[model samples]
Target: SAKRSVVSVSALAVGDKLPSDIKLSYFDVEGNMQETTVGSLTKGKKVVFVVVPGAFTPTCSLKHVPGFIDNADKLKAKGVDTIGCVSVNDAFVMDAWAKQLGADGKILMLADGSGTFTKAVGAELDLSDKGLGQRSRVYSMLVEDGVVKVVNNG
Candidate 1:
């Protein structure tokens, strides 16, 4: 599938404060709705927020999501708090996808329908060629207590 908007993350790095105050919603694969508070999600432990252009895309479905989903237990053993999957889609879409991928319980699927959070983190992607406009880049960030620790496999 082609993407319309591409998203990118700029100037955010380790030790820098994250904008956890942003409001967002996400959906499970079963089409359930969920509203989330970033701050509360990162209350303690390390957080890994992974952003993708879409849920069922070739790369994301076959590799990206699997990498984290397969390694979720390993990360937890390392004291990691949570894993988030974000996209510029609606809560229902995200929710449905998460459930489809069995990520409803392990991963936090966040919806950035307006691209507000995606732009804030500088992870916006430019997918004009593919038709996904201004969506987040494929990557993951490790945040500790609302501060960035590292952006992995970006």
Candidate 2:
């Protein structure tokens, strides 16, 4: 049998509207499962969505998240409304990771447990061969009023 792969799609870029159907589930600081849609989160604000493969991973733990955490205030002062960290992990894991990284209040920890949101954004990375299921690619985007304005990826 031929190996199956996720369908390739054009990555989201500046001027594209975030898919309204992409709903992300997250746990509040108090550990409550809360549901939010992409439109609800970025509807009328300047949001920075920092997407990582997983929570607690080395690079994401040591670098990607830290950069956002440390520069959160600066970004806010410059007019950013929110900085959200998203991963293909469950709400419990995401909440725990947020506390572990001291990002509970500094950043919005969003759990895309289903990877639906990730795929909708054209950033899903397949890692099933490595024992990990479909996950999000590491990337960040600046969204304003639900429209992408900037994208950064390594």
The number of the candidate with the highest lDDT is: 2
lDDT per residue as tens, model 2, 1-154: 9997653333887899999767787777677889899989998899999999999999899999999999999999999998999999988898889989999778999989988888887887898997888999888889999999998874
User: Mind giving the per-residue lDDT tens digits that candidate 1 earns over 12-89?
Assistant: 667878777787897644555667777877877588888888877788888888788889999888999888888888
Task: Identify the runs in model 2 with alpha carbons over 4 angstroms from their true place.
Answer: 1-10
> Model 2: clashing residue pairs?
none
TM-score top scorer = 2
Badly placed stretches (over 4 Å) of model 1 are 1-9, 28-32
**Candidate 2 RMSD computed on C-alpha atoms after optimal superposition onto the true structure:** 5.9
Q: What TM-score would every model get versus the actual structure?
A: 0.84, 0.90
The local lDDT score (0 to 100) that residue 72 gets in candidate 2 is 94
TM-score of 1: 0.84
